[model samples]
Target chain A: MSDIVFTNVARNFRRDGKEFPALRDINLSVRDKEFLAIVGPSGCGKTTCLRMAAGLEFPTSGTVAVGGVRVTRPGPDRAVVFQQFALFPWKTVAENIGFGLVANGVAAAERARRVADVLKLMNLAGYESAFPHQLSGGMQQRVAIARAYVLDPQVLLMDEPFGALDAQTRVVMQEELVRLARVNPRTVLFITHAVEEAVYLADRVVVMSRRPGTIREIIDVASVRAADSWDRFEKIEDVMDQASFVHLRTHIWRLLREQQAPDDH
Target chain B: MSRRTVVGIATLLAVAGLWYLLTAATGWVGSARFPNPAEFGTAVKQIVTGGYAGARIHEHVLQSCKLVAMGFLVAVSVGLPLGLLMGWNRRAEALINPVFLIIRPIPPLAWIPLAIVWLGLGDGAKIMVIFFAAFVPSVINTHAGIRNIEPFLIEAARMLGVRGPRFVFGVLLPAAAPLIFTGLRLSLQASWTTLVAAELVGALLGLGYVLNAAAQDIFPAMILTGMVFVALSGAASTWLLGRLEQRVTRWRTA
Candidate 1:
């Protein structure tokens, strides 16, 4: 069975007595351990798609199943990293990472161990006591990532997780996400507006059409795993400069650009 | 000290100098209604050392503080949870809000006659009035605080498998805290404003009681003394509230 599946999903939201459809006739499947990115314009239900699988949103008419079981509500099996980082302002970095584990009734020692592991892995070793506001935007997003990663859920759902960061930070976060997937492979249903972001991190990029969004195309990119080295950042940055990376990015950009223009008479 | 502190002290001195000049020096304003600065100073010394209305000045101040603390605490204990419920659950809001709206617009001082009839001329009536004053603002602001929580925060919490009470206390409350504290501060101010008004009905020991008696006797010095006490206490409470708010919401600062 696929890690996640959306079978004929449609979502409708009502506003002022009008039933506005956000997504329609959506059918997709994410293979186990696959990193799938959905790239689309704003208001195109890319987020709606990710939220449906996360069980934060329910499809109006279709089934969202994970591991062959239908999703009825949010469960520990799937974890989400939101765009705003949404780290609890009152909580220190360690507390935010340990939140889910504590809720799950993990023993204190084990929770601390897991939290320490994620913080170290995310390169946030000594800053565990700092609050979210005390950290930079990039560091805050790293805490958010560690928050999700510590859960070790079956699937990670990211909704424009780095969209708020500056360009340089966004690139670094993307590389961090790639390294995370390499070390501990899991299904990731990633959504982004940046074509390069989608192409860089995804195993297969799912191009979504405009409103009442459905899958337009799914392009498979060559996978580049993190090399076992201290200089992982340089190796990943070099992946972006490859000819295939440029070619694929241009192709996705053209597809998105073409969809934005009005159809010819 | 800070520049702001220097400016504040300067402003106070300037205002006092103007009042002294007008009433004591120029005699442009009569000292009957507005006591001269020297007489006011003597009254303060007399009240602090000698006594006012057969009770020490501190006794009256302490009594008023007790009334406000009791009423404000009761209002918060009841209103905080009630408001949180109203904000969280639609049915609770529908059931409770209409009556709250109708009664809220009627000022707490307006409740004096009815409170006297119901609870009699005692501490009960005074506290009831202060409670009403504090309760309305507390409930309204707490409800608003909960309602104003960012939708993204709720979404993020739910996505992390947080729900029910954990979500309410853990996610909702902290997110709504800045506004909740704002509600508390407003409620506290309301409690103080209505304290003297509450003490008007047959009370004989509070600052309000002393001031009322002094007003009948046309003792401007006593009135000014009472005003000074009220001003000082109000400033103290506000400063305390500010410190509390700052400490609780330190996370808001970068």
Candidate 2:
């Protein structure tokens, strides 16, 4: 069964007495265990699409399905990792990770075990009792990832998960997420504005047009791999050289610029 | 000793020295109104031994504390849940907000006559006055605390399978606790002030009653003693609440 399917989805928002369309006629299917990234300009509704899939927002029209079931609301089956590292300030690192388990009424012992496992995986084993404020930005994001992972969701929805991090930390988190996806092959719908992040993590990158967002192109990066001696930067440059990747980026850049241009005529 | 203790002692000595100089100077204006430190000390000893009033100093202190405690308990029991409801539901806000706005403007002491009419001149009337004084701040602050939570945090929690009462208890309450504690502290102080005002009417006990009696006899030292007791009780209660706040917000400090 397909992990997630969005059929001609549309979303509109009413602001200041005007209705603005965000996403329109979007159709996509993410296969089971596939890592898909949606990349677009600032106002292109890439985050909106991920939010819909995570059940934080309902589509204005059309349907979104996960694991062959129509997603009516958020559930344990699709855990979301937000961009801002939304760890509960009052909860310790361990407690935050175990929040979903606790809410689902899992036994205390089982919850503790799962939290411990994920903490170790996220390299946050020794920081279980620390609060979010006490942790560094990168560490807090690790906690966010651990929280999502501990849920063992069939699909992971990430919205610019490392966008707030410094360059070095962002690259580190990207590699960690890659290693994580390798070990636990869950379908992921990742959203980012960064082209390098899209190329590095996604099995396929779905490029979106500017506001009233529509899919411009989808570039499959499954076969683009680094040679044995090539470093990560070289691998990224190679991926950027692919004609499909270059075309998609330039095409998206033009579309965004047009969206920003004044309507003089 | 700690710096706070050292500074406190130094301040006390300075005040005592000033009092002695003022009383020693006969031509000094309003010298009789402010007694010397020695006279104040003697008066405190007499009050402790039931020299100034029929009742000992401890009796008044205990009475005031009992009233404050009862009033604070009532305020918390009513205010916390109401605040949570208002914060959680927009409908509750629409319905209850007008009533709160109407009631909040009326001073706590204004309720004294109604409380007396309803409950008679007793502890019941005193506590009711105090409760009215404390309730408004507690509810308003608690509602603000809940409303001010980051929207993204709530969205994140919802997307993690949290909903209904579980969501409120697990995420919302913990997040809003520091702000709520602030409200509680303010309410407690307000309750103490209300208790004193209530006692001024017809109370036979409490620091307020003692202060009134001392004022009638023009005994500045006894009046000062009463004032000191009131200040001490307020400070102690506030310090206790501060400790509680620290415990609840320890996670943020981590």
Candidate 3:
């Protein structure tokens, strides 16, 4: 069964007394424990799709349902990892990770236990007291992911979570993410502009067309990465070297490049 | 001492040495208008050991501090919450901002007459004047502080089930604290300035009272000493607040 279902979703934002469509007729469903990546150019509403699922924004014309209930607003059952990390500056890594549990009124002792578990899972144990600014970009993103994981949400929504990191850091983070998914599997809807990242991480990649974005194609990552033995390519370079990886990357690039920009003239 | 501290002390001494050379050593300006370093020392000693304007040096400092504290505490307690609500809610801003704008631009000293009429020339009148001086900036800075908090942080808080009172305390306040402290510092400095003005208009004891009395008596040494006290107190309070800011916001990067 699907964990998240979007039914004919359309969103329009009113600006200067005019309704501008952000997403239109978008229908998608994320299966339980599936890793789905949505890729498109900027302004294609890929992030909007993730935000809708997170219940941060509601579609103007359609419904977004999580675990069979219609989403009205954000809830603890679903968590988001923002592009900027969104870790509270005043809070240490551990406090930021435990913020949700504290807000949910988890007892302090239980909060500490769960926070400790996630810290060890994300390899953030010793850095608990370090503030976000004290950490490197990669480490901060790990804290962000750990924060989401600490809540044990049924679905995770990430909006370019690694978009801010340097390329070298991005590669390491990408490998860590897949490692994280293997240990703590959940329904994930990841949004990104990097086609290679989509091909690298996602079970299936959803390509979106420009402006008032709609899904153009859904490409299943090929046999090499899709096989049960895909774990054999544990290293990112090894995964990149696979012939199927290059083919899927080229395919998504062409699909994205072929889409025309919406004509306003 | 650290190099930075050593350099800072050296700079202060050099400035004082230059002042001594200009006034006491060369006697370029007469002691009538400009008191020499030796005279300044004597005036301070006299004030400390004896008294100034019928009140000792410590009494003048204490009185001025009390007036500032009264006005400052009230302004912050009222202004910060009011400004936060004003910035957070569109309706609150629309309703109260116009009256605030009208009151804010009028100089605090300009309220001396109105305060005298309403509250009389007691401590009440002086505090009222200082209140206006501190209140305007307190409100403005608090408003800006709340408004300047990143929108993403608020969204993150909401997603974590932090809303209403919890949202304000857990997220908004801490996130806005660095800026709020800045507002507090500015409000405090403003209060100190208006303290002098308030005492100059009416009061029996304060550094400002001492300065006015010394000016009228044409004792330049006494005036200079009073000026030094005021400058030193202002610097000291600001430094104290800076230290407090550092202690509270250890998470913030310099």
Candidate 4:
């Protein structure tokens, strides 16, 4: 079953009392356990698509459903990791990660156990007591991802999760995400402006046109992932040097760059 | 001790030495303008032993402190929740802000006449005055604190299945805690100032009454001692509040 499905989805934003079309009749489905990334230039409403699935925003026209049911509001079945690492600053890392469990009425012992497990899974075992400000950007994002993962959500919506990190840290985080995916697979709808990140991480990369964002093309880049390629590659940056990776990245970049050009009459 | 603490203490001492040099040793700046160090010490001992305006130093200090506490507590109890509710709900803000804005700018001491008529010349009147002083900052800061939070933090909390009153208390309250503490700190300061002002007008026994009595007698040293006690009490409470703020917002990076 496809965990997330956006069928004929359209979103219009009201700005200064005028209705501006953001996403135009988008049709996409993030298959169960599949990692689907949407890449586009800024203002393309790629995030709007993710927000629809996460139930943060409802489509103006069409239905965005999960597990065959309409997603009317945010639920425990779907978890979102924001670009800003939107952690509760007053909470310790463990408490921040365990917030969802607490909200769901998990017992204290069970919440603690799950938090500790996720902390270890995220390679943040030693930093349980550390606050969000105390950690590096990469570590904070790790906690954010772990926070989402601990809920065991069927669908994980990541909106430019590595966008705030330094270039080196971003590369490292991408690999870490891939590592987590291998160990525990979940349906992930990733949104980003980076074409290369979309190619390296997503099973299928959805290339979107500029606002009134339409799906220009959906490229299948999963074939590029050799069975042992993730394990063999020391860094996600190493995958960028390969010919197949280069070609796919360039093709998506061209589609995005072409959208920036003046339209025909 | 940390260099910062050492430097702060040294600065205070240097200012004290300057005061002593100018007033007592050099005889520059008349004693009438400011009391000498010896006269200030004698005033302190006199208040401690002989009493000031019929009450001992500790009695005056305790009375002032009690009034401040009552006023501050009442202000916080009313202001903080109102501010948080105003911040969280648009309808609440619309309903309450108009009335709050009308009351906000009026000086707390301006209520003394109304307070006297309403509650009489007891602790109630003094507390009412202090309450107004502390109330404004508590509301303004608490509202601003909730409003100024990163929108994504709210979004993130909702996305994690936190909603309704659970979201407000669990997420919004603690999320805005840094600024709420800032509000509380300002409220504490306002309470002390207004408490003194309230006591000055009519009280029989407070540090402010001591200041009024000293001024009546033209005793600069006694006035200085009263002023010093007010400062001491205000500073002590503020320091304690700051420590609580530090513990609550320990996640904040220095």
Candidate 5:
């Protein structure tokens, strides 16, 4: 079971010789093939939580296990898609996607085949040789997502991957994401501040509290999808319009809003 | 040609015409102070055929270019890797930075006396001075380039399981390359200028040596000829470097 288990996780950041907690007691068990979106207000340490799963970070005091193995450093088992669409600027679209395969010592012919297949899967067939700067924000993020997915990792950690795109592009990406997840499911920890996004795509939504973040609420969004999956609504707009979607989105929004610091209000 | 190139060419032609009117055509500036194109042409022919000091004009140009190439290549070989080490490892930076801080403030010309004392008045001393000139920028800019990179890119690579030497070679080197090239360009300019100044006091051959001899002899035409060759050679090296930089970083939008 390619599950991610975060046991009593806490993390602190030091700035100017001052120590401040960023997350505390983040106990999340993201099940295999589950789409778990962690939603909260900005500075809620949602991204930090995702980074720990990617093995790019460590908790000050807890065990983060991927497929039952304790994460110490980044390994081939997990892939991350960052909010900045951090594609290697020197590498082409195809090169970026195949970077993991290369790192794994996958031979050239096989690497090309898998990269080409994933390119088609992501609807990025014709833009292989193009650079990241040449592509629009949506297309660049698609490449980033494609890069992570091509790894065939046990877990995919995304830190607000769609947060940089325009509203229209973000919705379209969400739709594409839903379609892809249905076909090739993997345990995914997606972090976002968008309530509709957290509600529209996740099987379960974990709402986080303000800094020194904690799991304020764990929401089951898939109940409304008794027989039909969220992918049933071909368009993100259609999913956003569902009565159940609106209720869940509003509930998560209210939960997140309450967690915002009082001083800010 | 594009509008920009065409406009640039026209501006150069306009300046040349103004120079011609001032010295060659009107004789208003006086040829003694500023040689006419014809007088400059005569000087160029004399240097080309008769030779200057101990060598021909082309030989002097070749010598200067060789000195620059030697100094620049050595600096790049040593400085590039040193910069990478410092940029990649904090411990390396801590170890190297103090010495680098002490060495960095001294001008390349300041080393002339020491270079002569250590290596003597020859190609070796001149090369040493030029090496110091090129070395500083190569290190500083390379370090800056690596530090300036977005930290997220490193996270992305690490997540993809790229670390250790692979991370340094595959990720850091390429990411910092454009800025490294920027440093190389500065180093190139430094090498040229430093070589000239060093050669002025110590060299038997080179453009600077030619210029020094010309000034002493009060041969305005030869001085003009020497200055033109120096400018021409500097432009040539910079142009070649620009092409290489473009090819390496072609992924960037112009």
Candidate 6:
């Protein structure tokens, strides 16, 4: 069964007496355990797409479904890792991770056990008692990831989850996410503006056109994973040379540049 | 000693020295009005020994503390929930804000006459006056604290399956706690100040009553002692509130 499905989804936002369309005709589906990255320029509705999937926002038209069920509101079955590392500032690392479980009426002992496991998985074992403000930005994001993961959601919606970190930290977080995806096999709909991030983490990278965003192309990265002993950085040229990757990147870049151009109208 | 402790002691000594200097410098001009430090100390001793107007200073201090405590409790109990509702619901804010706006500008002292008329110049009137003094800032600060919380935090909580009253208690309250405590502390100070003011009219046993009686008797030393007791109580209340704030916010610092 498809883990997530978006059928002709549209999102329109109203501001200052103007109706701005954020997403238009978004039609996509992800199979079970698929790692799909949605890539687009800023304001290209990538985050809005993830928010819609996570049920934080409603589509102006059509439906967003997960595991064959339509989404109307946020639930514990689908967890979200926000871009801003939205860890509760007043809560300890452990408390933040356990929040979802607590909200769902899990026993204290069970909640603590799950929190402890994620803390170890995220390499944050000794810092469980530390407040979010006390942690570094990278560490805070780790807490956010752990919080989402501890809920054992059927699908994970990550909205540029590593965008706030330093470049080195971002790479490390990306690699960590890749490792996490490998172990858990959760259907993850990741969103990012960075082409490299989308290419590195996704099983298939879905490139999006600039605002009033529509899917430009979907490039399967399965071949890159199939290659043995390949260095991601070293094989960048080879990866880009793939007909699908080339076509998708070119189409997306052209769309973005056209949107940025100065127009008299 | 810590720098804060040293500075605090130095300030106290300087203030005491100034009081002594002022009384001594002004003695010839109004000996009945201003008392030197030694005379004030003598009056304190007399009060302790039941030699000053046959009323013990301890009774006045106790009465003032009781009134302040009762008024502070009443203010916090009413203000916090009102503030939280106003902050959490836009409709509640719209409905209640006008009332608070009209009432807030009038000083608590202005409520004294009404309180006395309603409650008959008793403990009820005194407590009501103090409550009126403290309630506005407490409610205003609590509302500000809740309103100032980042909207992203609320969205994050909601997305985590925390909604309704559970969300308010589990997420919103903790997030707004520090600022709410600040409001509570300010209200406590207000209550302490208003307690003395309330006692000024027809109160039989408070510090203010004793001070007024001392002034009428031209007993400058007794007046100074009464003023010192009032200052001490205010300082003590402030110190207690600081400790409470530290305890409440310790988790955020962890």
Residue-pair clashes per prediction, in order, are: 0, 0, 0, 0, 0, 0
- Superposed on the true interface residues, model 6 gives a C-alpha RMSD in angstroms of 1.4
Report how far residue A95 has shifted in candidate 4, in Å.
1.4
The sequence of per-residue lDDT tens digits that candidate 2 reaches over residues B176-210 is 89888988998998998888889988889888898
Residue-level lDDT of model 4, residues A107-224, one tens digit each, is 9999999998899989999999988888899999999999999999988999999999999999889888888988998899999988888888889999999889999999988866
Give the range where candidate 5 chain B is weakest over 10 consecutive residues by summed lDDT.
B245-254
Local distance difference test, per candidate? 0.87, 0.85, 0.89, 0.90, 0.90, 0.84
Interface RMSD of each: 1.7, 1.3, 1.6, 1.7, 1.6, 1.4
In candidate 3, how many Å is residue A27 off? 0.8
The DockQ-based CAPRI class assigned to model 2 is medium
In what order do the candidates fall by TM-score, top score first?
5, 3, 1, 4, 2, 6
Candidate that beats the other on lDDT, 5 or 6, i.e. the better one: 5
lDDT of 6 by residue, B1-254 (tens): 99999999999999887876677755653556677777877889988787454468788888899999999989989999999999989999999999999999999999999998999988999999999988988899899989998877887898789977889888887889888888888898898788877888888888888887887888988888888899998889889888978786787556
TM-score-wise, the better of 4 and 6 is: 4
TM-scores, all models, native as reference: 0.94, 0.93, 0.95, 0.94, 0.97, 0.91
Query: RMSD of candidate 4 to the true fold?
Result: 2.5
Docking quality class, candidate 5: medium
Q: Give the DockQ (2 decimals) of all models.
A: 0.59, 0.74, 0.64, 0.64, 0.74, 0.70
Candidate 3 chain B: worst-modelled 10 consecutive residues by lDDT: B245-254
What DockQ would candidate 1 receive versus the native complex?
Answer: 0.59
Ranking by lDDT: 5, 4, 3, 1, 2, 6
Which tens-of-lDDT digit does each residue in B168-214 have in candidate 5? 88899889998899999999999999988988996789999999999
lDDT of 4 by residue, B46-114 (tens): 999999899899999999999999999999999999999999889999999999989988988899999
lDDT tens string, model 1, B202-232? 8888888878878888999998888778777
Report clash pairs, candidate 6: none
What tens digits encode model 6's per-residue C-alpha lDDT throughout A1-265?
5399999999999999999998999999987899999887677898888888888899999999999999999887888888888888878888899888888899999888888899999999999889999889999999999999999988988988888899888877877887777677799999887776777678888878777898987887766556632335443456556665666566656655665525512
Model 6 chain A, TM-score vs. native: 0.88
